[model samples]
Target: MTRSELIAQIKQKKSFLCVGLDTDLTKIPEHLLDEEDPIFTFNKAIIEATSDLCVAYKPNIAFYECYGLKGWESLQRTATILPKDCFSIADAKRGDIGNTSKMYAKAFFDPQVSGFDFDSITIAPYMGKDSVTPFFEFKDKWAIVLALTSNEGSADFQNIENAEGVQLFEQVLEKVNSWGSIENTMYVVGATRGEAFLKIREHAPDHFLLVPGVGAQGGSLSDVCQYGMNKDCGLLVNSTRNIIYASKGTDFAEQARIEAQKLQKEMQIELEKAGIC
Candidate 1:
């Protein structure tokens, strides 16, 4: 999807919620195990239940890759089942040298290469421009660079400052923005880092942000929208464990729907408050 298409979806849905398909086979209801592919079964239910309530779905690749071939199959099935209008992302956090990165790009962006053609893929910027530039080689696809993550370990490197006193992440946002326009580039800013949002926005006010750390992670939806929303409502706030695994029983999908609805309703209010509605 192009940037304008994403912005249009946000407007039409009155939401910026991005549901995370971090599907773990061990965590899904045991009943689903009867199916040939329990992971895909769980994901299909979650997508069907929450599709109308949110604008995007992100499948974290590690969850599938750990399980080997079957896990990968589930990831492909999940991607195929997602709503067409809703944005899709492969949370692979992939980056390598130019040539290698090109293969990773083909894996996620090429429908023929990856089985699942995602609208975007999460990327790591620590390797510099060659690592990221390859992903943008595809048409209408996106590269969501990791700027400030929610993990506790982020403080180890992202927070370190240089002589100019600029945090490493801030420097990343500044430098990486040069490689792609706001139309194709995005930054991953954890919702837990709500305090850093204002400063983060100061560097790239117009680009979209893929925000995780809400719900089970305890990142406040209200606080995230208050500081991170731009004129185009540039945020894809995500919730994973909280929504998908809300219940482990037969009514799991229903429970997931309720959880997704709560977040969507909260987002509706935030949009109105920001006068973006």
Candidate 2:
């Protein structure tokens, strides 16, 4: 999707919620195990139940890669059925040399080569520009670079102060923004880093942010919006276990919808408060 299209969806839905399809076979309803492709079956139901309430669906790649060939098949089927109105994210945190990065980008963005046609892909910035630039070559697709992650270990590298007294992540935000326009680039700013959003916005006021760690991770939604929200409501707050696994029974899809609705209502309120709705 183009930048304008994404902003339009946020306004139309009165939401910026991104539902994470970090589906685990063991965590899905037991009955689905008998299905030929249990992962895709579960994902289809969840997408059907909550597509109207969310603007994005991010399937963390590892969740599918772990199951080998069958896992990839499931990922393909799930991607094919994703709502056209919603953004599709291959949450594959890949980073490597130049040539290798091109293949990774093709895996998510080029449907002619890979079965999934994703709107964005998460990228680790450790390898610098070559690792990230390939994704930008794909028109209208996004490269969501990791900035301030929510994990405790993030402090080890991301928070380490540089010679200019700037944190490593801040430097990343500044440099990556130079490579592409806000239209094609975004940063992964974890919701757990509430006040950090303030720091991030100083560097990326117009760029969208793919925010995780909200619901199940105990990140405050109110705190995130207070500092991170831009005029376009440039934030996609993802909820994974909290919504998709709301119930492990046959009523799982219904429960997921309820959870998704709750987040959508909260997002609507935030959008109105920001005067974007």
Candidate 3:
């Protein structure tokens, strides 16, 4: 989706919520296991229940890759069923150089080749330019680069400063911005990094941010909006465990919708406060 299309959806829904489909077979309702494809079955239900409440859906790739072939099949089905109006993301934190990165791009952006086309993919910037630039080759697709992550170990590298005193994540935002326009590039800023959003905005005032680490991770939603929100409401705050795992019973989908509604209501208020609704 183009930046305008995305922004329109956020405004139309009065939300910037991105629901994470980090589906785990073991965690789903036992009754679903009886279905031919439990994962897709579960995802379809969640999508049907909450598609109107969210503007995006992110399927964490690792969750599917772990199951091998069957896992991939489930992912394909899930991708096929995703609402056309909602932005789709392959949360595949993939990074490689040259042809490898190109192939990764094709896998997610080229539906004819991989049967899984996503609006964007989470990319690790460790491999530098070559690793990330390949994704931008696909028109209208995005490269969501990892920056200040929520994980405790993120400080080990992302926080390291250079001789010029610029932190690694700061340098990443500066350099990556040069490779792509705000229309196609976004950074992964953890919601847990509340105050850090003040620093991040200094470098990327206009670029959209795909924020995770909210809900179950205990990141404050209000803090993220207060520090990170832009005029366009440039934020896609994701919630995984807290929504999807709200109930492990027959009412799982209903429970997921309730959880999503809660976030959507919060997001609507934020949009109103920012004068973007």
TM-score of each: 0.98, 0.99, 0.99
Q: Give candidate 1's TM-score.
A: 0.98
- Candidate 2 has its poorest 10 consecutive residues by lDDT at 108-117
Q: lDDT values of the candidates?
A: 0.91, 0.94, 0.94
lDDT over C-alpha atoms for residue 74 of model 2: 88
Q: Write the per-residue lDDT of candidate 1 for residues 1-277, one digit (tens) a residue.
A: 9999998898888889999998887899999999999999888888999999999999999999999998888888888888989999999999999999999999998988667689999999989999999988888999999999998899999999999899999999999999988888999999886878998899999999999999777788888888998989999999999899899999999999999989888989988888888
| Overall local distance difference test of candidate 3 | 0.94
Of 1 and 3, the candidate ahead on TM-score is 3
Best prediction by lDDT: 3
Which pairs of residues have clashing backbones in candidate 2? none
Q: Which ten residues in a row have the lowest lDDT in candidate 3?
A: 110-119
Ranked by lDDT, the better of candidates 1 and 2 is 2
Pairs of residues at least 3 apart in sequence or in different chains that clash in candidate 3: none
